[model samples]
Target: MRPQYPFRVRHADVWRIALPACIAFITEPLAGLVDMTVIGRLGDASLLGGVVLGALVFNIILSLAYFLRIGTAGLTAQAIGARDPADGLLHAVRALLVGGLIGIGMIVLAVPLLMLSGWLLAPGDGVREALADYFYIRVWGAPFSLINFALLGWFYGRAEATTGMILQFIIHGINIAGSIVLVQGLGLGVEGAALGTVLGQIGASIIGLMLMLGHYGGLGQIVDRVRLGELFQRVALKRMFGLSRDLMIRSIALQATYAYFAAQGSRMGDIELAANAILLNLLFIIGFFMDGIAQAAEQLSGKALGANWQPAFEEAYRLSMIWGLIIAIVMGFGWYFFGPYIISLMTTRAPVQAYAVQFLGLAALCSLTFMPAFVFDGILVGTTQNVVMRNGMIASLVVFVGVAWLAQPLYGNTGLWLALHAWFIARGIIYWWALRRIRSRMFAQ
Candidate 1:
């Protein structure tokens, strides 16, 4: 076997992991497209508006729960690097337990959560009713979705991108197919769409469990006679929860920026709201592509740090940056040339199409501005640098608010896009500076 110490990281090394991760990430936006397409075809802008708003509410909630994925991935990656299968298994177990508890909490708090979101979003009357229906149905799947986060993070930490890719495919495939059946054939409307997603999560969780068991040589092998009490050790629990708390804060700050973006668009008008939703999906597509490279950073950097090899870590970071930038540029050009056609497929509304096209160029531009932040996020998260991540996101949110406050009144939607870009640019700068200052210190013996 080749030695990894001097880590001769190459583009191929990044792409090997990134390609499958990219496909998995792309499935997310594709599922969004399916939701919009099914609802948009119903030919009511209000219905479309409801799905958009309902999605944002979940996005915020899920962002809070996202600690399961990011924290588990970082911790498990380091465990894998150190060749500690037991530690990796334990990390996954802890994450799943915490995720399940959090999911149940969300269900218990569903009513108040919905009411709070409705008041904050302030959509039109027609949209409000539809959003309520979607929320009630979707909340039931919270546990499944949360547990899936843990499963996915564990796979990525193992650098098992293909497994992660397969898991995502199963979830999204079920979502798109079930949604079509329920919404189109059964005429369930937005409720059907919501139920489809819930069903997908439930199905995926079951399959994920079976896969994990089979891979680990069944239940007996998994537990391996370890005392149940060991899983709840105070030091381990504290470390896990501490990491979760920081990642949760970072996720909330990130989600707040997106929620604000959707909220402002809602206030504009239904057509504008619908248009912005389409563009937001496009932005997600771009973001996820870069996230593929970020996954590489997470696995490689975490692995390097786990092995206590600075050279490998540096090479991983360098390779990730190069590939991230390349993918961003490619995506920008792809959107610029083909965005109109894609927008046309999403909706039949002439005004929505025109408005979305008007801002398509700016959305494409985001691919580049957002690249640095994405790459840095993977590296930091993989290295378990949670403090920097939490602080950077909060600071970037402030920059976003300031930019949007000044830009929105002056340029309308254009200004809103600008503010979003400013947020990403700020994140890139802050993460870059922090990493530079701490790099040598982090690798110190």
Candidate 2:
């Protein structure tokens, strides 16, 4: 360790985590942006709709498996903070093993899962058929995708932000470039785009694995270093499961609720659905930027917890909030002022355009309320404050459903978005309340 800001207990530790993450996440959208551009040029509305549905499929499967990363980061942070290399290595091993299992399971269940997704979303004929094509081709990358999640999560937990940044650039970069060439140069259409995405993921996973070989010591050599009995132990598995369990519960609740909002949009009409999707992706510009800082909080707080040093934890939290709020305020204004232009860039539909204006207005309003909750989430995860994270999200889920019922009837699609915005505010409140345990202390005595 060169003893940088985060290492020296310096301020701005959150930036250390967030800056790279934000940059990485920003570039990440390039692939999707390119895909959408290509699909848009296809001159067929069905093709566009199919890509949207395909995205939903990918997000659903990948989102459910997010626990691999969350669990790895939390545990890794603790180990790093405790100054235990063994802890880091073991956490990495566990995440890889779990990721492997998840990937295998998903592959086997692909047919049923895709079928279920189609039935659940109830997409119309054109979109449904297009989505079916995208799903089949893209789902082949399941194993690599899961492993990549583990690699990123493990690195993030260890506060190795640069590694994640490098991998993301390579991964998303390939995805963007590959999609462009396949879809445009080869004229493979939507299928080409999907294949490009899968190839990009596989390539990124291979690189990540190679990095593990020397970037931190090959993840594959674990058995030789430790007894087989140790790897399969009940206690170790239980701890990983425990952390993942809480995160899975939170993710499921939060994700399912978001899906509900999406379904609500669908019910309102395709115009609303299209508008919401554009607005939501635009919002990602802000959310992903903030996610970087939150990722930082997770690493710093987890390590602080392991060190049993309350002061470092406070420093990490304070810095995360500082950066999170700054990004929120600045981005909120940007979204408010220039959002119309951003939305206009995505589609040519006039009705969808009209509705997007209203939807974006609400998105800006919620940005303030949303940023803290997001950053705080990473903090709580790092602190292994799982119970509050889980419970608080569940509480907000209820409010979201309740408000959606009332608002959707009165305000229609805008009301549905408003309901979600409220849920965002509530999400922050819960985590802010939960951090009381270590918030009061400046340092360990």
Candidate 3:
């Protein structure tokens, strides 16, 4: 019998990759959860407020480098599909080199970052000082974190989800343990939380790089030709910067939208912000789980595109949606059943808990369309449909801001929650159109 050159795409691929990757993604957020827990344990709302505010600032900076992982994933997946060994390795190298430069740049801007964070967050001196400490310690780890983004992105791009999963486990496991030790045992407070984060990211980056490098035989293969050339050869550099630039635009818009959410919450006061922090994390789980399907689609679609297997390319979406909905429904239950217990445990204030429950409840509703949006996002990334993706995100942001501004004056906190939930729905609708358009164009040929 002839060899079946096109192997079947299994649901197991998603579970195999996404389950650990999902757990890893979930646990990675635990670092923030840890910070909130430790700080909340202090019996100081101010501390809770400061940590949440500080962390938001930290993520905004980190989010800018998201392209390093996402763009790398698209390029790497293409290599995997083609069975071409060269592109994947070179892809990893490109990401790592870029990661190093970002690290240095982060350090140089550290002081200014603090100044800017203070200016933007506009907390009084006491909160500002604590936030500054958190910012400084976390900032020092920028190189490691950014590099990890690149490495992990490449790993996912190649559908080597298990490697990224294990790396995340090791990273978060150490970070969580370190956080409890420093914050509780040593009484390091806010700074301890920051220190734990840095150590965890640094340790994880080291391990992730080792595994990723060793995954494809060894680095010697990459070192031979790549070392001799102009590191930024025009054609290659153009692709890197071009993809990087577009992805960066997408990240900025997405991050800015979240920033808008946080900034709006800040104006409403701390309990509202804390409640939002809790609620957003619950909503965030939807994205994490959906990414499993989306990423699987991303890998499969890229492979299909490379092979020009129109049927498999088409099958990827149908396959992704079927799987995506299942994961979202499971997470939604996790939210509805257990979320209140978790949120109540996190905060001491009655109003905070009340708001949290309400917001989380609405998140459950918001996620009805979450899976589709995510699967579509992966499709876009896989297709290298950056411009459309960017446009979709921008449109979503406008809807979000417009709705929030219009609603908040009338509904107060409830209005904010409503706006938040509606934003996801709007995102789902707009991106669905974009993805469908791509599907049509791909097949129309």
Candidate 3 lDDT over 269-382, as tens digits, reads 998898988788678866776767777888777766655556777677677888888777777888888988988786779999987887676667656656777888887787
lDDT string for model 2 (195-224, tens) is 888888899888887877775466556555
- Pairs clashing in candidate 2? 18-292, 18-293, 213-218, 311-442, 311-443
Candidate 3: which pairs clash? none
| Leading candidate by lDDT | 1
Alpha-carbon TM-score of each model against the true structure = 0.90, 0.90, 0.88
Q: Lowest-lDDT window of 10 residues in candidate 2?
A: 1-10
Q: Which stretches of candidate 2 lie over 4 Å from their true place?
A: 1-8, 124-129, 216-221, 269-271, 358-360, 411-414, 437-445
Q: Please rank every candidate by lDDT, starting with the best.
A: 1, 2, 3
C-alpha RMSD for every candidate = 3.2, 3.4, 3.5
* Model 1, residue pairs in steric clash: none
> Whole-model lDDT for model 1 versus the true structure?
0.89
After aligning candidate 3 to the native by TM-score, how far in Å is the CA of 216 from where it should be?
Answer: 4.2
**How would the candidate models be sorted by TM-score, starting from the highest?**
2, 1, 3
| Candidate with more favorable, higher lDDT: 1 or 2 | 1
lDDT per model, in order?
A: 0.89, 0.82, 0.78
